[model samples]
Target: MPKKALIAWGGWPGHTPEQSAKVVRSLLERNGFDVTLGEGTVMFADPKLASFDLIVPVITMSTIEKAELQNLVLAVRQGSGLGGFHGTMCDSFRSETDYQFMTGGQWVAHPGDIIDYTVAVTRPDDPITSGVSDFAYRSEQYYMHVDPGNEVLATTTFTDAHFPGIGGVVMPVVWKRRYGAGKVFYSALGHNADEFAVPEMALIVERGLVWAAR
Candidate 1:
């Protein structure tokens, strides 16, 4: 049977959640997944959430009810894979520490807001990044507080121009971790749907999603 995927999107409009969802849904479908699209967090409250092989959240800076959040958490913990990009995953529930803990990071700020930067493939041998070379792009360079246990696949260096304190600091651009038996993947690259048009960025995210699926 084909793997099932659920994509729930809705939050800050500036991030173009709907457009991003459509882009991701297409990718998933093309990859042989049975995709379901949802409009809000209420979809997360589904008791059958764990039935899907993968869950993708395109929401940004939005709130989820306690029950809905808990259900999503339980689904992942019980072996439902969770994967997403940018603020949708890391910046979704700011007040929920458990959600952040499971995701392996949280977006704190973008130092320069749509600045040019290079993404270095730190783990080129890894399946998710193999054969993909380092590439440069113009987008929000996310500065995130990440979990030490995460296996970082790609990273970027921050300069002193924007945040002096983080000068020369390396930040994880893509990573994957395990929550219970579930695989969790994330990338701090997609600022909008159009950003995925960058070949390298799109490939990395597509590979990450497949790797994260249950």
Candidate 2:
């Protein structure tokens, strides 16, 4: 049987959640996973969320109910993979504790202009970062409060921008973590539709999706 994947998108339109989810779904489908794209919070609701090998949450900042939060955590903990980027995965669900625990990080702030910057691959040996070099983007440079034990795959050393206190900070641009029996992959990229269409960026997301689902 083909593996199943759920692509849940919503929260804020500013990040282009629907467009991003569509791009990601096409990528996953090309890789042989059966993909479903859903709108709004209904995708994250309980009873409809547990039947997939992967859950791709392309949502930005928002609040969700307690039971829905628990459902996602339990599903991922029991072996379903979770993969996303920027506020879609990290900066999302700020008021929810369970959501943060499952995601392995939270977007604390974006000091710079949320514009272009260089993302450097720190672990070239890792499959996700393999053959990938430093790349530039015209999107948000997310500063996250990441989990200590996560295996960092890539980072961006922040340079001076319009923001005064933003420079010289090392931020994880991409990473993977083991949560119980499941895998979690997050990248602080994909803040806009064009970023998702970037060649290397597309590969990074595709690889992260596959690796996390494994």
Candidate 3:
């Protein structure tokens, strides 16, 4: 049987949550997953949430309930793989430290929002980043509060282009971390459906999704 996958989208729609969810649904299905979709944080509280092999949150700046967060975090801790991109995962629950702890980062700001930047693959040998060359990208340059334990695969350096005096600050663009027995992966790429068109962005997120699933 194919592995089970759940994708839930909600909160701010500016990120095009529905479209993002659909893109991921297609990708997961193509990778032989039994995909399920949910809207809002309601699904996060589902008692059976941990049954899936992977969970993807296409959410942004949404408030999550205590029960919902507890269940979701517990799911990952008990081995439900979690994967997502941009603000979808990391920026979802602003008030939940546990969620941030599990996801490995929180979106603090996107300096120079949607401008040209370079994504440098730090771990070229990692499966999720292998064969993906450093590429020019036009999207949010995420400045985040990231986990020190994360295994960073790709990064981008900030310049004083938009925010002055912050030059030479390298930030993790893609990373994977362990939350209990679960595999957690995130890419600071894919701000919208259009970004998935970029080969480098698409490749990193696609491979990262597959790599995160149990």
**Which candidate number maximizes lDDT?**
1
lDDT of 1 at 50: 98
User: What RMSD does each model have against the real structure?
Assistant: 0.6, 1.5, 0.7
User: How well does candidate 2 score on lDDT at residue 82?
Assistant: 93
Give per-residue CA lDDT, model 1, range 65-151, as digits (tens).
Answer: 999999999999999999999998899999999999999999999988989999999999999999999999899999999999999
In model 3, pairs of residues that clash are none
| 55-159 per-residue lDDT for model 3 (tens digits) | 999999889889998999899999999999999888998988988999999999998788999999999999999998999999889999999999999999999
The weakest ten consecutive residues by lDDT in model 1 span 160-169
- The stretch of ten residues in a row with the least summed lDDT in candidate 2 is 41-50
Q: Candidate 2 clashing pairs?
A: none
Per-candidate TM-score against the hidden true structure: 0.99, 0.94, 0.98
Candidate 1 wrongly placed segments (more than 4 Å): none
Question: Relative to the true structure, how large is the alpha-carbon lDDT of every model?
Answer: 0.95, 0.84, 0.93
lDDT of 1: 0.95
Clashes of 3: 0
